[model samples]
Target: MNDSSVGQAGKAATVSARISPAGGLDILSRNEVARLRDVSGSGLHGLLRRCALAVLTSGNISDDPGSMFELFPDFDIQVLQQDRGIKIELTHAPAQAFVDGQIIRGINELLMAVMRDIVYVSTQLEQGGFDLDDSVGITHAVFEILRNARTLRPHVDPNLVVCWGGHSISREEYDYTKAVGYQLGLRGMDICTGCGPGAMKGPMKGATIAHAKQRRRNNRYIGITEPGIIAAESPNPIVNQLVIMPDIEKRLEAFVRMGHGIIVFPGGVGTAEEILYLLGILLHPDNAGIPFPLIFTGPKQSAAYFEQIDRFLRLTLGDEVAQHYQIVVDDPAMVARAMVRGIDKVRNHRLDNKDAFFFNWALNIPLAFQQPFRPTHSAMRELSIRHGRPRHELAADLRRAFSGIVAGNVKDEGVRAIREGGPFDIDGDKDIMQALDALLQAFVVQHRMKLPGGTAYEPCYRVRAG
Candidate 1:
């Protein structure tokens, strides 16, 4: 074992030990183990290290990925292939993950999930196992990934609720999310989220108490994230079932497919990106009459936030888009009842259509939404956020615009790009751009753009209303 002190001035102590998998990731081929250990620039070791660190430091409040790395510069993990299956060797792991020198059981399970997903993606998806060039193939790939992770269960009722919101939000909004989650939990619903703090954590936190009160067991608090954003927004500790998709598009797809209903709380660009993604799909001509339920809710203080979001949707996508979701305010019981009713509708629809309760196979997600949008400066500049296009198509572009801003705000690569260049240049239709600008500015003013009390946020993109 190598002894290396990490943290500033060695103030944060570390631990070294070999941990046996808690069951989910007990086996790996020799080649897979080798890939995880390869420390070259083109290898998976660096990616593995980043994700492992994020899991170890679960419940961290910082959105900066670099800060964690800075705190644990010498931390390392190794996958050992043994006849008895596999073991993880940790070097200078965060002391927080350990209690009395033993890694926390929940965190250990999450760490195994990290290794499981990285190895699975490297061996299955990145290789020629699945075609990623077309829409059908991408959807199939997402299904297979969830299946491998054991997230898809047969013979289960449709009770999973997908909650989308900002990781950075106000205290009132956070408490409101928990209240809604509690209400949902009391009704026997599970939760799925982006797996970060603030809104993501609140619902799961609230649900636990409700589940406990109802004596429910094995309630799933699933968290789906991708490599690009996972470090910035680490998986919250409440996520018992965690799956790391290969990219944001797939991660978003996972949420909609696996969830029976969606409840959106107050959030920033990331939440907007999710709302647009779902709205774009629902607005597609082929998806008309689908029974998926979507709700936008918050404390009474967040009424303006939802209003701005609603106005932005109506202005950009037309009033038809507003039909896709309902806005519920301050009443957790009402939100939960509405969600329960919505899930019942979804279940009946699936039964009538002979669809599986576990996945939404009938949703017509266009190739545009399925395709990954890399928020490069050039791509951001090329986005067409204007009128006269198909409403769904326009919604797709708007989603990309917000997605790029989310990247610039928290994603390491996007942040680096802004530092290297300047804020992303987003120029589009005059009216739409103005609405978008106003919405984003409100997020900044409300402290929704970043975690509360971290650092002052500078604009990541300059919106030009043409």
Candidate 2:
């Protein structure tokens, strides 16, 4: 790596370097390279630059998506096609990503992942490689993307656990996540998450220690993210294997289809969106027999948080929805033990059905759940958050409601919309609206809506009980 300090005076310190690709991504087609270099509105360069910068500044904590760009105004990345392989050129990149002018190995690989996924999605998925219009095609696309990233491990028993929680969380809750991860690691389980800070990083961090102590090698710490959320929550350093899905919908599907079990920590609307997405699928009549383990756990202090989630879920989706998940508060050991037992069942079920252990191909996901729901103000108002619809269908729309709030809170496009058109209007059944309003109020009070110490959060959506 050839790098030089381009920072002068009090400006943000940065380095310029040309480094070889790492982590098996050594080549790119000329067309792909050109597309990555293109700076037009239709080109993939903007997406590439944003995601590359996010990984380059891996440990920074700021929810504002544009802050990084504002801080590093001159940063730019270009793919240089070479006779040997591809080389990445960095201009005014974050100095922290380097030590003695050498790029950090993990960040380098993650940067490669960013390039790999962006190029794949733009050239392959969008260029008639995937029939994104249909449900099966979308699932197939997801599988192919993960396969391309080399994330699928064949012949391995079901052990990958997808942990979902808010980046913005309390210290106690974050530590509790680490403890649970430590136990899961001790049992030889791998960790997968959104690849951000706080809850997403905690399990992976704890698992590293356990893996080291247990003499476990070739352990996987996977982090799955999409382009929109990556800027707000940069990928944490603990993620050894990083995969970027095409969209939020695909990202959620990847979690359910890839992992044997899911452990949800206390979080905000983003976490709520994940819960509704999974439960909605599990509640489907076809998926009723599936033995996927869903556990909601946090420290004792989070009992009330779980209670609020429980009430909202029960009221909206009916009492039977609770059958899909188990709630265990204040016990990391119990959570790990329960997850282990649940994965055992999942393994057996996969065997009985002749399904692969690496991917849950037997599970049914409807087109509604698979399709991306862009949260424009109009779309937010159109969501049918009512009582009498089928439980699964209602859960899908309710998931959209929270998903819209998540977009409003973090995504750049959604934030600009909210700024221009005022907070999104979420109107629904009187009881459901009241419940949703109360839940969001609690998130605000607990500082779960944004990273702590940031500017006070303004309401991005207004709830109305119609």
Candidate 3:
């Protein structure tokens, strides 16, 4: 293995080593390697470096992507082509990923995943393997990405529960998430989460123990994230399988399509965005009678939080929307029991319809939900969050509204946009806007918007109720 000394920042030691891919990602063509090495404006080098750094610093909590760059200013990664295989060379890499001069096995696996996804997405998706414009095309692309990552397994019973919640959560809420995960794990259910910290980590952590007790081997803790958010929320160490989707919309679609059920804990705008996205799709007439179970859950103290969310959903989407999900509070056992029952129904439904258990091919996701929403000022302002529209359409707009807030809060480009153009302006129906504003204010007041003890979070959007 070739090694060279790279300069380091003050007191932060770095390492340089050539390491082989740990997770069956050894083969790479010359063109693929060139794309990864290319540092030009159109190349994938910068994206690869940023994502690699995120993988190296897994479990280290810091929401600021810029800060990570500053901390490891000299860090570099290169994909070296060899006659036998490919070798990943790291320069000034994070020392924490190494223990006693060897990289941790889990981190190495994740690093390979990062490289695998980056190379695959650049070559396959961007270079015409899939058309990303049409709705069906996008879905096919999503399926292809997941399939390439080996995420979809056939003949598996429907037990993957997608856990949605904020990375910034209270200690009690975090524990509650673990409790729910423990219950789920005890029932042989696997987990799929956005896979950062707090709620994301808690469930996987709890499930690990329960899986151990049950002697459940090869239990999947799947983490799906995108490039825009990966830097802000680094993957937790608990993520056994990680797939980085091309964008947030695809990531959300992956969650709903892959998991049999979804359980939402208290979260900020991002979680709200996820909730709206799923509810919007479920509300579609085409999706009616689908057995995709969704549950809103939290600890006893978080009852008010779910109450507010429920009230907002009812007010905006009508009471009928409640049928799509059930709210469970302070009852981990009940959550798991409900999930098991739900999964049984999902299994029966999929069998009756002859659908695949690993992927939901029957769910009809509208084109609006598939297309990426750029959270520019004008785009945010033009969202039609009025009650006069169809409930699903209204939910779609509201989801975009919250998505904009989430982008402004954590995404690098959105933060830069806010710094350049001030907060995004969101104008909509009077009652809906008032409810939206109140919910956001509560998120801020409860320290849900940003990680606790970080700098005070300024509003990223101005709500103008018509």
RMSD, every candidate, angstroms: 2.0, 1.2, 1.4
Q: Write the per-residue lDDT of candidate 2 for residues 142-174, one digit (tens) a residue.
A: 999999899999999999999999898899999
1-466 in candidate 1: lDDT tens per residue? 1233333314567777788888468888888888899999868999999999999989998878788877788788988888889878888788888876778899999988888888888898557887899999999999999998999999999999999998888899999999999999999999999999999999999999999999999899999999999888888989998899999999999998899999999998999999999999999999999998999999999999999999999999999788899999999999999999999999999999999999999998998998988888999999999999999999899999999998898888889899998999998999988898999999899887864246788999999976
Give the candidate number with the greatest TM-score.
Answer: 2
Q: Sum up the clashes in candidate 1.
A: 0
TM for every model, in the order presented, reads: 0.97, 0.98, 0.98
Task: Give the number of the best model, judged by lDDT.
Answer: 2
Give per-residue CA lDDT, model 3, range 104-124, as digits (tens): 888889999988888888888
Model 3 / residue 242 / CA error / Å: 0.6
Worst 10 residues of 1 by lDDT: 1-10
- Worst lDDT run of 10 residues, candidate 2, spans 1-10
Q: What lDDT score is found at residue 224 in candidate 3?
A: 97
Error of 2 at 169 (Å): 0.6
Q: Please, what is the whole-model Cα lDDT of each candidate in the order they appear?
A: 0.90, 0.92, 0.91
Clashes of each: 0, 0, 0
